[model samples]
Target: MREVTLTHRECVKLIGSPERARYGMVSVDGREPRRLTCLIVGDGDLLIDLDRERPIERPIAGRPIAVEFTHHDQRGNGGWTVTGLGLARPIRDGDKPIPMPYTTLTVGAFETGVRVCIARLTGRRTRPTQI
Candidate 1:
């Protein structure tokens, strides 16, 4: 439950990497949370797959949204953080004459996934510590 931001360059690097299973909770315009499975497309755009557990309403493009998730490296070390996502654009898969209601968002902002916690020390010298 932390806030994070990622630049367009960083986002491209992340999504361009090898495929992996990454899951996160996405909130659009402060609406109810929804489960999201993201896949980085060849163009570095995020193909967000929505969970069908609950009904999904399409989000308007250019709306502010936030996503929180944990990222894992090849060594399997990652932490949880919240990211402020840029404008959300709705995208559909395939070239059907009729369009689906799925959505895809671009990585347009940047934020670090680092969480800093402060603790009060009793009977000990106060020092800065990061968790």
Candidate 2:
């Protein structure tokens, strides 16, 4: 379970293209983690289409967030995890909550978030456990 730092190239490789999508762990303002997935698309900029069982009413337009994508090999092979940073508008700028049902809320506490620019990514190599 010892975490290891990965190079830029390694990070990109682990996070394959859109075709090879997997869920990532997302947390805003160090809150609880939620499940989300998206393609690497481009370098340095990460955009997440966040989904929740229920809508959130807190302000998140300009809140700092963290995301982690992980993989574990069941056959004793080494696996890795990637963590990234994000950005958004001022929290108060878009504090108003977005109405639910059929509305697209961007840069708020309900729907989408600003581009998560992960300029640099670190890695965590997973150690296989003995059953």
Candidate 3:
């Protein structure tokens, strides 16, 4: 029997479009299997997607992700931010949590290949008068 291969590029394609319901699976050396049905649009600006089958449930769902990030903003004040992104699911085991902005998860074909980063959600800087 051949195993199903899900690549990072495939996940990226799913994120590019505006739709709902994608089928995939997550696997690891010693752990339970997880299935993912990522909904890209809906649930506000944030992308609603996750693998619910994890033994330990995480509150990652409904979390916001940065689609387009900007460093600065207009009037040289606060930056324009947009939070909402969708991507592949994470695969790992053992109850452990780190206090970092992002989590490096073991996923897909590469070792240390999958990175769940909390990117900055900022828009391009514009002059206040433009607003």
Candidate 4:
């Protein structure tokens, strides 16, 4: 496995495209994993919407966060591991505090690569990690 870092623009481009975007299972420094949908707004802010059943006990905005996942190459020959790390920012809902399950992230860097062979496997899109 190799480490890859993504620039803000690169991060935006990846998340901005619907075809490239996938629901990510994210954890903040080893916290319980949560389902998160990420997108880059036109203004270049990376928005992360969390799926949660309960209110957040504390503010997570400005906290450091990382997302780990596997993505297939265009040809589906191999799986490239990706990890996006950034600082959680806040998104406003017009006078309402940012909801418990939503956050805005300023993507600072990411690490990906060192492809793992999975082409021989069938019935699975990508191997799951124990994030």
Candidate 5:
């Protein structure tokens, strides 16, 4: 486990590759991390979407969070993992309301109301290991 500092361009190149799984695990307040769908990967952060497990639960903006993304694809090769710390910011539409993007999955397309959040990386470390 070594810390590899990646430039913005390098981060995009490695993370944007199709070989990487389109999912990440995110945790807040030192709680157990949960799997989140990777919505969009930016130069310094990622847009993640998740549903509230309970009606009254949701991670608020400005909260600290930990994120992890890994590579896993058709080749079945052992992949690397990128872990980082970030802050969560809920996506807002200028005070109008949150916009739940219409996302389509294996089943079909539907506008499922989900909590969209941004994990703005403050620090990151890379792990290169073989299975």
Candidate 6:
């Protein structure tokens, strides 16, 4: 099994698009549970670093989201689920979108069904990486 580990910063960079959500392709099976890139926006423990030079929203210091991505395979369909702590209400820190805590997201069809989760981490910290 191959695992794509993304740091907190990596997640934010992927979330650069302003469409609320975006479409990222990866070399994986086009079946249910295919790994893909996504942005989980909610009232989760994640935070938006709208203060950065590029200003990318990233997962907070403690919340790390588990992105289970999948696509259509011969057996069934395709989709992805980002599970973690999320928001309970709309989080707007200034003009940017701030995710809440404790939520689950499921995205599919490359555009049709997009799900974003929000979660909080107790004390998890991931180093930022350049995409």
Report how far off residue 28 is in candidate 2 (Å). 0.8
Q: lDDT tens string, model 5, 11-32?
A: 5566556432245677776777
- Where does the lowest 10-residue lDDT sum fall in candidate 6? 47-56
Candidate with better lDDT, 2 vs 6: 2
Best candidate according to TM-score: 2
Tell me how many residue pairs clash in candidate 6.
41
Comparing 3 with 4 on lDDT, the higher-scoring candidate is 4
Predicted model with the maximum lDDT:
2
lDDT, residue 92, model 5: 47
Clashing pairs in 2: none
Candidate 5 accuracy as TM-score: 0.55
Question: lDDT rank, highest first?
Answer: 2, 5, 4, 1, 6, 3
* lDDT of each residue in 50-113, candidate 6, tens digit only: 2221222333222223333222234433222222333322234332333322224433222121
Off by over 4 Å in 3: 1-11, 14-20, 27-30, 40-56, 59-131
Off by over 4 Å in 5: 1-8, 19-21, 52-56, 72-78, 94-131
Q: Candidate 2: misplaced stretches above 4 Å?
A: 1-4, 17-20, 50-59, 89-113, 127-131
Score residue 21 of candidate 1 by CA lDDT: 28
Determine the C-alpha RMSD for candidate 1 after optimal superposition of all C-alphas. 13.0
Report per-prediction Cα RMSD to one decimal.
13.0, 8.1, 16.5, 13.0, 6.1, 14.8
User: What's the C-alpha lDDT at position 110 in model 2?
Assistant: 28
Per-model CA lDDT versus the true structure: 0.40, 0.57, 0.30, 0.42, 0.49, 0.31
Each prediction's number of clashing residue pairs = 8, 0, 2, 3, 0, 41
Residue 113, candidate 4: C-alpha displacement in angstroms: 30
lDDT of 3 by residue, 1-131 (tens): 12233343433433334333333332232234344332222222222223333432454332332243222333455433223233323324311123211323222222212223333222232334434
Q: For model 5, which pairs clash?
A: none
Tens-digit per-residue lDDT, 75-111, candidate 4: 6344444455655655554312223223343221112
- On residues 6-55, what C-alpha lDDT tens digit does candidate 2 reach at each position? 87777777876333345677677788888755434356344454443233
